[model samples]
Target: MPDNVPMEQAAILADAVSTPFGAVVHTEVRVGESVGVRGAGGVGTHVVQIARLVGATPVIVMDVNDEVLQRSLDLGADHAFRSDDPALQAKVAEKPYLNRT
Candidate 1:
């Protein structure tokens, strides 16, 4: 957040720093590609947003927690599932390209 921005919104700086340096810089995520983030933790959550911003479709996010999985869906993931769920493999298989990292 800028010096003049609200202090409450300072959390935005997390992704503001990670999005460009981590996702966009190190990865070769292309448009129309599918992305599957294995965890919905801090970094993984940001990856979900970055993937969507770059035009990734059917963005998938997998985690052990139901709330986190749902949160990923709310954050732009097309599919969110528990990592241990047997159905996860089948769902991932359905995507044309899944950039799981």
Candidate 2:
């Protein structure tokens, strides 16, 4: 852990940081790439930040909660939407790199 970081924060960092960091590294996320996170809870929130940290463009995050979706935007996501939005599929389809599945 870095000396500047608080121990309490550092302790949870491993849990909150590892998965997203590993996924970004292993996926070889390149600059200008697009990233989509399906959930906006603990893990999903970190994924948004990690994707932006790695220079991903149009980081889209989806969740059922409006507040969580907004939080994703506050963090780093370029787009936020409810999972059950009537136009969700259409909106996603319009994005060039967003995988359907």
Candidate 3:
């Protein structure tokens, strides 16, 4: 996560799409670490930043667009890849903080 990134948008999207009853998007891991989270849209750009605030170092972002991938890298992703990659799950798994769900 980059410094000064806000998480409000991700909080809204996660609740709108997956969580019930307007939940808090932030999650704390059992291992006492916060995971890098990429928002599905433009909002995702912020998720990576906020993840850093919560303690994920060297944030990684996920996107299908090449430009967005580049922007994400510019925003401070230590590394990044397309969500559409054939080996997407494998690549994600390579990150210590992000394994296949």
lDDT of 3 by residue, 13-101 (tens): 56444441112143542223434445435456665545544455666666778888887777656677887789977877777754447
Q: Once superposed on the true structure, which residue ranges of model 3 sit more than 4 Å away at CA?
A: 1-25, 29-34, 38-40, 95-101
State the lDDT of candidate 1 residue by residue for 33-101, as single tens digits: 777788988778888888888888878888999999999999999988889988877877766565455
lDDT of 2 by residue, 1-101 (tens): 78999999887678778988898889999999988899978888999999999999989988999999999999999999899999998988887776566
Ranking by TM-score: 2, 1, 3
TM-score of 3: 0.53
lDDT of each: 0.79, 0.90, 0.57
- Candidates sorted by lDDT, descending order? 2, 1, 3
The local lDDT score (0 to 100) that residue 93 gets in candidate 3 is 73
Name every residue pair that clashes in candidate 3.
39-44
Which portions of model 2 miss their true places by more than 4 Å?
A: 1-11, 95-101
- What stretches of model 1 exceed 4 Å from their correct place? 1-21, 94-101
